[model samples]
Target chain A: MSLNATLIAQLIVFLILVWFTMKFIWPPIMRAMDERAKRIADGLEAADRARKELADADTHAAEEIKKARAEAAVIIERANQQAGQIVDKARADAMLEAAKQKAQAQADIDNMAHRARAELRGQVATLAVQGAGKILGREVDAATHKALLDQLVEGI
Target chain B: MTTEAPSSSSYILHHLTYLQLDLRTWKIVENSQNFWVVNIDSIFFSVLLGLVFIGLFWPMARRATHGVPARWQNFVEVCTEFVDGQVKDAFHQKSKFVAPMALLVFFWVLFMNIMDLLPVDSLPTAAEAMGIGHLRVLPSSDPNITLSMSLTVFFLCFWYSFHCKGLKLVAREAFFHPFGKWLLPVNFVLKVVEELSKPLSLGLRLFGNMYAGEVIFILLAAMTLHYSAPAHLAPLTGTAFFIFSALALVTVGLVAYGKGPWMRAWLPLLILPAVIAAGSIFGFLPAIGGGAYFQILFATGWGIFHWLIIGLQAYIFMVLTVAYLSMAAEHH
Candidate 1:
């Protein structure tokens, strides 16, 4: 064959090769590739979903923590208020007890003084009656004894 | 010498030649004078081969499962992905249809290439007995098939360019950018050459590689036949010679074994001896370098070892196609 003929033949063959392959082989290949890309996109979507769930859980946990802290603060404040009331009540009761003890002591002193005074008066009367009876020197009647005692008492 | 013994080289060359067909037309359209036609044996077998490929793959497509694919289904998916990945990497533009087109090119071309791996004498000898001639089964080896397939791809590329960019944009790319408005004539010429070269290079590359490999295998078989040992010597001294050779080989093996531990300490020392031994035993290793055996080796290696390439190529192609379509849709 001439060089030109050979080149033309080569050209024709080349054209045919390209034609057949493009028609038959390419479609299936592209379909498979599309399937693969879709699979990857799906995997990414799953990951995103998991991330969202995780973030929600974290937010929930933080909310729970804040609620618990608020509850603890209220309980602590209540306990402090109750403790202050108890201290104030104890002080008031102690002051009342001290005042009652002072009053009782004062009343006992007054009663002791009155009883001593009465005893002293009785002793003095007895001594005076004995001395008068000795001076009169007789087992006199009630009217004579009385008249002597009266004269002695008037002179002292 | 009563009959000259046929030399091994001549034997090999004879087997490799194609049976020719005459399809030339001389007077108007009645009788063809000297134009070639399809070899009867080749046509029958090539069709049969095409059917076999379709049969193998079509069923996988038909019974494609939706969820948690079976082994066969997975295999198909992997193969598809591999082709797509390659296409995506090579061509950046997304074609609504071009990526799939590239995929078809890869697989069909691959199937055609694999036909060369069949035994050299099997198909042709069978055809001869059946009174048929000019059998050429491997389509990749045929320039006609390869070039035709490549040109189709080239045209598809042009179609995609035209469809995606529009006629005006394609024209601008062809005649405008590289050269200024002043050099539109020169730019047009260069563009034409560039466009023409695509299919020519692509088709020729695949065809030449496959055909050369087929020629080499035929040559190797001829060598084995020519180097056949004597007939009478097989019975008489064959057993004694075998025993002697076996003993020598055993001794050599023992020496090599003893040297292995020492050799392990120094890799450089062992490399030469290993190469020599391997070369002598395998007879220079078939197909030298990058021949048919090499091509098969490379293809098989790619299939087995660099499997990632196949899948990646498929993926890239698919994504690019999608991206292109999305862009084109926006324009519309």
Candidate 2:
């Protein structure tokens, strides 16, 4: 085939195709590829940030839980100590009250003993006075006898 | 068979002829080419396939997704990316046209070169059936078609050189290079030759190789076929048939697998003649189909090997185009 009109036609087709491809085909696909690359990069960055945040949150939560637990332990120990002090205070108060009541009861018993002794002496004096009167065959007076009885009691 | 086919030589010659249209007369011509006459088959196929190439990519370009691409889109994208990468590597200056241009060149040549794989007789047989004649489909095999492409590249070379280097330096470099300003005349002639050779070789190399390959296919086709059976050879029977078959098979194997220097040297002298004689002897045996078995062996073998050549030719054309452009654009 001699070089002819076909060359021109083919060259035109070649140029047109090349131009069409350059203008329309290339830019968009390349842009899409660039966009895709950026998306992937951004996605990976977000993932990295999220992982860091999650790790921080995990550590923070653990710290908060640990603090709460420690506070609870301290509270429990303080409560135990306070409870022991209360029990000791109650025991001390009860011991003091019991000692005071025992003293009061012993004092009452001593007072009753003293009264009985005085009463016994009076009875003895009266009986003695009455027997003297009976020997002398006369009646005994209470006013003079009372003084004597008191003196006799004092002497016993 | 098929309307009593012409002699094998005529078959081959007919296949080789192109459907030409004389531009001056505005009339169709065949059996010979004239000035201003173009091979319409090459033009038609080239234009048609060029459109198809663009058509294939057009949709992909439109709907090209940022996400997972469609299969066809992926294919187009990969090819584009490859060409883009190659251009980036080669050309220092970023030209918007380079990658897409390379893409067009590569796929266009690829599309044209692949036409060779179609069975040799298919197009011509179809043409004859249609009452038309002499349609060669493979466009790259035609020098006009290939040279047109390379000439386009050649124009671009100077275009870029003048554009990038400015007219003064281009003129200076063209007029004086290795021998310097003292030998301007020699340098001018040498420069012209050098410049002409770049595109010349690029175009002609592809043209020659492809033309040779087409010729070989034709020759192989010729081998299988015979117009008239040799009048002497009667139908074979008994031991003679087996012996001829054995000899033919051996010759075909030797011809097919014989890459050795001895076989290459002797093939024309001793081997081919022996095979032909055997083929005539076995021509009456319809199962063997004359010497066509050997033709089938070589054709199939070469056809298989031609896949690499097709891909490589397209690749080489593209790479050299880029290299030429790069040298022009970046050269100080």
lDDT (CA) for every model shown?
A: 0.52, 0.77
For DockQ, the strongest prediction is 2
What are the per-residue Cα lDDT tens digits for candidate 1 across A82-102? 999899888988888888887
| Candidate 1 lDDT over residue span B1-332, tens digit each | 00133577665655544444333531222112233443323334445545544554555565554455655557667866665565566545545455444444455445555556544543443344344433565655656555555565565566666777788877877787578789999989998887777667766666666666666655555544433333332222223333333444444434333355453344435554564344322332222333435434543444353234333332333343334333332322
Q: List the residue pairs that clash in candidate 2.
A: none
A115 Cα displacement, candidate 1 (Å): 5.3
Interface RMSD of each: 6.2, 1.7
In order of the candidates, what TM-score does chain B achieve? 0.60, 0.78
**Cα miss at B129, model 1 (Å)?**
7.5
The first chain of model 1 has a TM-score of 0.51
* Cα lDDT for residue B189, candidate 1: 92
Shift in Å, residue A78, candidate 1: 5.4
